[model samples]
Target: MTASVLSRAGADLSTARESLARAAQRVEDLLGALPVPGLRSLEQRDRAAAAHNEVRAHRVDFMATHATEVYDELTGGRTRDLRLDELVEAAAGAFPGLVPTAGQLAVERSRAQADKEGREIDQGIFLRGVLRCDLAGPHLLTAMLRPTTRALLLLPDFQRTGLIEMEAVRLERRDGVARLTMCRQDCLNAEDERQVDDMETAVDLALLDPAVRVGLIRGGEMTHPRYQGRRVFSAGINLKKLSAGEIPLVGFLLRRELGYLHKIRRGLCPREPEQWHAPYLDKPWVGAIDTFAIGGGTQLALLFDHVIAASDAYFSLPAAREGIIPGVANLRFTRIAGARLSRQVILQGRRILATDPEAHLLVDEVVEPAAMDDAVERALTRLDGAAVVANRRMVNFAEESLADFRAYVGEFTVQQALRIYGEDVIDKVDRFSGRSE
Candidate 1:
């Protein structure tokens, strides 16, 4: 009932879902086609309405039966808890467009907590509320059921990659603090798929290693002439790849969602039973920003638990100027800087200086360039302790529900995927726009 059988069952479930959707669409079309009241003879209008109602009833019946069948098949009729693989598959069948999101496993646990506190609401009504609250439907459903699904594998050992050796990312640990620096300075640390992969691996290594209690992310020396001899955070996505037509926009978006953004949202750690209640990493993440944190750099800053930025640092998301969407920022920044500020930065390419109040809100502290090391030390001092993880967990619970974050990521991924395939929107910036020989 596992391998091949599970695959076959999944296929059947997809087909059943497609059929149900088509049936539902037909019902909608029939209702839409019905003549307005008084526009047609009463008998004619009533007949059309009757047909619409009949099809709607049939679609509802089919959905109920099909959902049950798929669920039972995935569960092997045992009615017991299913593993993560089974749970994801079952979710796919139950909900169309199911995709992974941030704080994914904590969804059910949050609901349970609310219930215990006498704040629980009806599931259907709660889902409707989430939709009305402007969260993505798939995200809400995934969050609602993610805790029920447990992954079979836990923490895996890390193997250093050749790419890391190439100096794209430098991962090192001193005392209890692990530093994962982006060392690709040629393009101001702009990331292509390869660079992103290296950084992702470095992040996972830093977060998963039990000996390390605090993780620090920063940049290496810049080799670009304009920014030469300076330490810069990042310049966002690699335009060289886009100009050369090497990387597809959809693939780049997926890499960002799964490899980078999701990892930042949900830290890489061995899955433990308590993870549903606190899906973040077991340690705090501190980002050290120097020079500029542009585009993706700014997005990364938003994901970090704490940020230590140099006084000279600035952040910007020029996605709109480049005719591309800053997928994650557009969703996450709203919580950090309200609707108006988020709109200004993402839509209008507004640069946020570290001294600005809006920027200070995101950054934990700002220091002179020479004081960055001391600033990192101060940030870590606050985070490093036996109860650090537990303290952070409490803070997370009080701030916002993981469900909200997961819902936003769901919407971000869908929009990004669509924009990637629409027009030549992604590669709008030409490679030859300005380059030094």
Candidate 2:
């Protein structure tokens, strides 16, 4: 009976693979026949869009039905061992025109405008299909928690001197604490590709370091004229770069949530799978919100064990106005703040001042700007005990399980892609930048 069941499963896998391959070929042919987006008539573009949507719906259905089998086939049953980028590269190779190559993504980044005429949107849909798959989505997300190559390369030097300074982030170990500071001075420490890469590398260092018992995130002093010498937590996503099509969909949007942020919340996974349940290489993290935590920055504060905010500091998630999802905030906010307040903040662009009684949901303490340093030290000292790890794990498991996060990302994957390329994105960004007509 077991052999018979196995045989039927194999047959189903084979059928699904064949069906998807034929669908991919049809999509390729249909896209090839359509004129470039700039030259296509409205009716022609509409028809093409409909065809694209139909193919995506079919692909999503297949992925949902045969997720584990298809993913195992793609990864040679080694999905547990592969990194996120490796998995994505494998998918790109298998599907050819359906997914963007690393080089193709780089070319898109160099463009002044996002490619509405190409397969990039289709690629986003394809990725979304994979993420929406229950087992496969969480597996892929877990893969992203592994240490970055940059961090590994710099580990030896850091081990010797306990310091690392990159273009957008700096890290130093002292007194059982790993201090990771965001240093993109020009843009008030806004996150872009460079910032995310450097920050993730810094995060890997903090988690991988043997002597560190606690981690702290704070903004480095800024050089921007408006906030010169002041530490502005983060200005959030670099809208200027975003509007220029410099941020890749996978590299920034998905990578930030599944990569560094997830690592911070869940801790780093081991390179080799463990036979027994082992604690993730995690430590308590504290956020020092000196000036403001806006958008991505606010989303970040949600994951920290404790957050210390300046009395005058503020928090907001303007993702609705910005035409994008506020990185995992949707999944986390309702739990921290009640549903109504979460909606106000995320949907209505409401800002929460640190000193407000309601701000206690996100911030553990609010201190005078001059006393922020002392508040952070107190929080760190309080959290540096041995029991921090176990408590953090328990709270994380109870609040947001890996499965819950996976489901959220599944929806975010496709919805964010659409918003990123939506006509409204550029216009909204332009208005924010004072460049709109």
The clash numbers for all candidates, in the given order, read 1, 0
Clashing pairs in 2: none
- Tens-place lDDT per residue, model 2, 266-366, is 99986646614754778899999988999999999999999999998999999889988898898899889999999999999999999888999999888
Question: What TM-score would you give candidate 1 relative to the actual structure?
Answer: 0.63
**In candidate 1, what are the lDDT values of residues 1-437, reduced to their tens digit?**
78998788678767766765565456446644655332556686667557544644544344344444444544554344443233444544555322222233233223321111111111112222222233233333333232211111112322222112435777777677778788887678887777765765666666666677888889988878888888999888776565444443323544465444555555543347765765556467899999999888998998778898999999999877766677567767887788999888888889999999888767889999999998888888888886867776676556546566556544554345344333344235452333212
Instruction: Please give the CA lDDT of all the candidate structures.
Output: 0.60, 0.81
Stretches of model 2 off by over 4 angstroms after superposition: 1-19, 33-35, 96-98, 101-107, 118-124, 128-134, 271-277, 433-437
Q: Which 10-residue window of candidate 1 scores lowest in summed lDDT?
A: 113-122
Candidate 2, residue 412: CA error in Å? 1.4
User: Model 2 compared with the native: what TM-score?
Assistant: 0.92
